[model samples]
Target: MAAEISSDLLARFAAIVGAKYAISDINDQQPYLKEWRDRYHGRTPLVLLPGSVEEVSAILKLADETGTSIVPQGGNTGLVGGQVPHATGNELLVSLKRLDKVRAADPDSNTLDVEAGVTLQRVQEAADGVGRFFPLSLPSEGSCTIGGNIGTNAGGTGVIAYGNTRDLILGLEVVLPGGRIWHGMRHLRKDNTGYDLRNLFIGAEGTLGIVTAAVVKIFPKPRSVGTAFIGVDSPADALNLLHEARANGGGTVTAFELMPRLGIDFVVRHVSDARDPIAEKYPWYVLLEVSTQSEEGVGDALEGMLMAAYEKGYAGDAVIASSLEQAADFWRLREQLSETQKFEGGSIKHDVSVPIRLVPAFLDKAIAAVEAFIPGCRPLPFGHLGDGNIHFNVSQPVGGDKKEFLAKWEATNEVVHAIVAEFHGSISAEHGIGQAKRALLPGVKDPVEMEMMRAIKATLDPKGIMNPGKVL
Candidate 1:
């Protein structure tokens, strides 16, 4: 809504954060303009790196006064183009990487306060250094930032036991629209005052406010661990094994992952260090883990459950890791599945979730639906079976044209999402509805829910400056 950015506006932005931190050159902004998946390439005129909250306030004040749009970015590792600017090339990009710092860590209270720019892996290392555990582990933890994770409400492998990024957060410090900072960073577990603003911004995908820092809950590190790689007869068998393991371990099953046999084959064929934990081939495989505070019988519990499942004909074969290195080797097969898919030509991806009891039915119906829609299409469905979140991806037919297959992205998406809708499942489970899923929101969300969200967004960001064209 504002006019083209003038020299005065650029100079003021530079004055707030020193000139060295403000960049306007077109060539220098390429790194910040693109996203991780290369799905969205936005265009912007300037990139600003503010070192402190005060500088961020100053920049927002100026931007609001001039009606210039602002796009906040962190690590540039988002998959849904939530942190990138729009294609208009008019908004300014604000990077929070300079605000990387641990404000405080209270081990007694089991809380750690950190700035938004801190890398997730760094926060995990800090928690480990203090003999505590932060259980938000993701594939992009090495390069992703806490702000981006909170913005997306990221759900990683540990979500089966712990929770999503929103559940781990105790409080947040956000800079609101028009340069007002909300100091709501409390470590208390119960705060039922009025409206919970923190929850609104947690999964808003940066469309409400700019999150500066947060106070996150931590837990005592596990003392004993167990990991197992099992070959299952089918998805139904895998779900049955999950219930059996949870029952046998006294609800201590920390992680349970399901993958198609083809995913394991792809990983073994592509990744050098990733070899199949189980030599036998089945239609489906499961990688499970259980941890306990006491170091008495972690491995025994896993083996006993597997044996019971084998006796019942649910499990075909199993391999329990004997050492820490062996456990890691077992997990390598699951974690490397996504990266190995790159060797395949073109892959259409979907992150959907259903009730744990209905996961088998949903997968069966969706896979059959996609195959019927396009014959010979390869479907690789894998993810956290315990939580019912599956990464249902489809590869092009063997020796098919990559571009031609990719051109049917919408058709393929419809075939899969129709089955999801029929089963009352969500189209996006872990990855949020950023720019990628904005247009499809109305089709999935109820009218009443969409109205409530729109009301909240209008109340918080009336001018529509905070991350336009995303989420809502």
Candidate 2:
């Protein structure tokens, strides 16, 4: 039962956080009400910026008692509408930006206890300050918070070597639905618990609970980093090159990204200081990376592997970065691929994953299916080839109207997702199924798993006050 907000209840909330922090003016809370992509615009009765964990608990207690829904948000850089509130204008939006803190950093243990509100880039710098590495590299790291990363279990270019955010997390400090704080922040390497409750909140998309703080694992800074650009005939050759590099490099391979010639052209035209590393253009391109803890001859090893690949006809043309500056520039081209698409036209995108071995087939079949639907539609599929996850995006045909192109979003999604299903792949790979994909969940999710998710939601949040209308 949804209860109407009374003047008395609003006053109580205002008193908990002081008048300044409890924002009610539309202009004051506009940034919090709108998502980063502007896809989902929400209205809230009040936006509460809690400064501490205890304050968060108190706000939740009041909401639970009054039957008011609470939506927890961090940097609000999410793609799936996970951080935005509903359009009802009745829910309370809880912003956690004030809780940013670095509680501890232990170089000996290679671990850091950081608050949820800390930005991902700040976390990386803190690790680098201590001469350690925090390899959760993403394009949005400058704005995305650690809590949002853990909530969505974010995966970026580094996942090929370091895995996703879930793999780097050792433990968490979460605030449960009913206003109780669960402090399970331990630095233990091995703990055989009955059930790993910490993982339950991870990738839950803030449905299970709000992660307040966490203790995350860190790695030693690689002494040597090498990057290379290779042109391939097809996705099959990209896969073969990946296998060869890993076998020869012996686990030092960190990234293997796939991009089409069209995507590279977009970057070169739109992005500043972007140029092709090689003179000749192939149908497909791959930016591969290798990192090693030892200072000895890592670049030599990478060049040697690429030479073998070229001799065996796996690579058409190639360029290995001769210096760290060149390596960074090479990666910048791959990282900005998605950003460059906006200038071309509206894009219908899918972040999906399949078995590593089946990726080549998935790409071929998906491209064929999409072209059949909309002729001349530029299929810009790229990202994390080593992990079998690709940001499969379709840019509108040349000289097409942006609005008209986006009007067929649903049709494009169906065609692409159908191919994903055929390969036994996930519809939402690294990004969670937020409000954007809520309607499509039942069609793809197993009935038994859906029921279990609902059951857990009911048990933990019977009143449905935590992030309502999301991921259900």
Candidate 3:
């Protein structure tokens, strides 16, 4: 055990949940310490599994009284290190897995009240069970929890239509620094009572408070769905196709994903049963889906849009999925793009966003810059082109030392992020600024904006016991 945590202190905290729930053994704590990408590893003297909101409140209350730092984790699938504790072993790790429960499901109101530990897939299932749809569809939905999604304001393929997590959530139940519970879970569409408090914690990433439960909005299930994979000449061509789809899709264009041939190559090589949707290889590809309430013309609308785009020289080749299985197959290729990159070697990832119109220009400049900086590196730039969130990932050169290439993570970020700044893009788009980008936050954020954020942090967490060394 670390010198900072006394035996008495550990036991005192353990007693709140139970001896069985408080995990102090290093082996048991290992899973909660390291992030998925292995980018950040931390150490904690104790990991508390809080089963109830009262237990979480009690833990935070005691931590506040003793000036102990607390790191709250949900699902342990965070790409960034925000959920992990620090290496000093002075902080306490609070896992919300035990809090998993669907508190309420009101199909009439089109909302579900769930605890923070509920997996995103479970939320979707709950919505589907009630003949509704919760459209936050991330590749990690099977493991990532609702709290983590709201904590990061996660965006996925459905963002073009349904919006980010912030837009999907109606209200939140938060536990403040001193163990005070803020019961702000309202199920109203338009509430003009006072200041919007839920928005503050939506993307705060557990620094302000722990989201115990939430009321999330759900939409009517689409009556019909149309999926298509199209080959494009470049990012510019994809943008043109997106414009045409938007004008003709009648607001049914739910997803417009931009992927490169390199990403497709990686997926097809690494994933079993994965194959290219298009017969011919193109510089870029688009995975477009149209979902609508009207089943009559959904397929025809999508086909008409694609046909018009093809005639206008926007799409080179296209394949409209005729069956549900084929559509799932196409989605599998897009979803596996990130996981398959590991097979090639080290990958430096950048999640950035710019104005919709500036995407092509930004991609051209950033890709050229990264390629020039690291010769022979494979850049796999792909993501939601409609919403302007690009996952600009670069794999290490063939037969290159993984460690040597990963050592350039910071330098590569500087090169790419500099171009992002030129296009007025955000350095961190859907992913929150965890430990990975904490230092870089200042350079990208405006001075006044940084000052305001710091002030908010100080006011909410004066002792700085809530998730230290994160966000602000």
What C-alpha lDDT does candidate 3 achieve relative to the native structure? Answer: 0.92
**Residues 1-472, model 1: lDDT tens digits:** 5557888878888889998899888789889999866789988777999999999888888888877788998888887788888888778899999989999999999999999999999899889989999999988889889988888899989998999999999999999889999998999998889988899989888888899999998899999888889999899999999889988953378899999998988998998878777777899998988989986788777788888899999998889889999998888888888888878888888989988899999998988988887788889999999888999999888888889988888888888888888888899998888888899999999999999999998988888888888998
Off by over 4 Å in 3: 1-3
- Candidates' TM-scores? 0.98, 0.98, 0.98
Q: Compared with the true structure, what per-residue lDDT tens digits does model 2 show for residues 288-321?
A: 9888888878777877888888888888888888
Selected candidate, larger TM-score, 2 vs 3: 3
What is the Cα-based lDDT of residue 472 in candidate 1? 83
Of the two candidates 1 and 3, the one with more favorable lDDT, higher being better, is 3
Q: Model 2 lDDT vs. the true structure?
A: 0.89
Residue 341 of candidate 1: its Cα lDDT?
Answer: 82
Worst 10 residues of 1 by lDDT: 1-10
Error of 3 at 152 (Å): 0.8
Model 1's TM-score against the true structure:
0.98
Pick the winner on lDDT between candidates 2 and 3.
3
What order do you get sorting by lDDT, best first?
Answer: 3, 2, 1
lDDT of each model, Cα atoms only? 0.88, 0.89, 0.92
For every candidate in turn, the CA RMSD to the true structure comes to 1.2, 1.3, 1.3
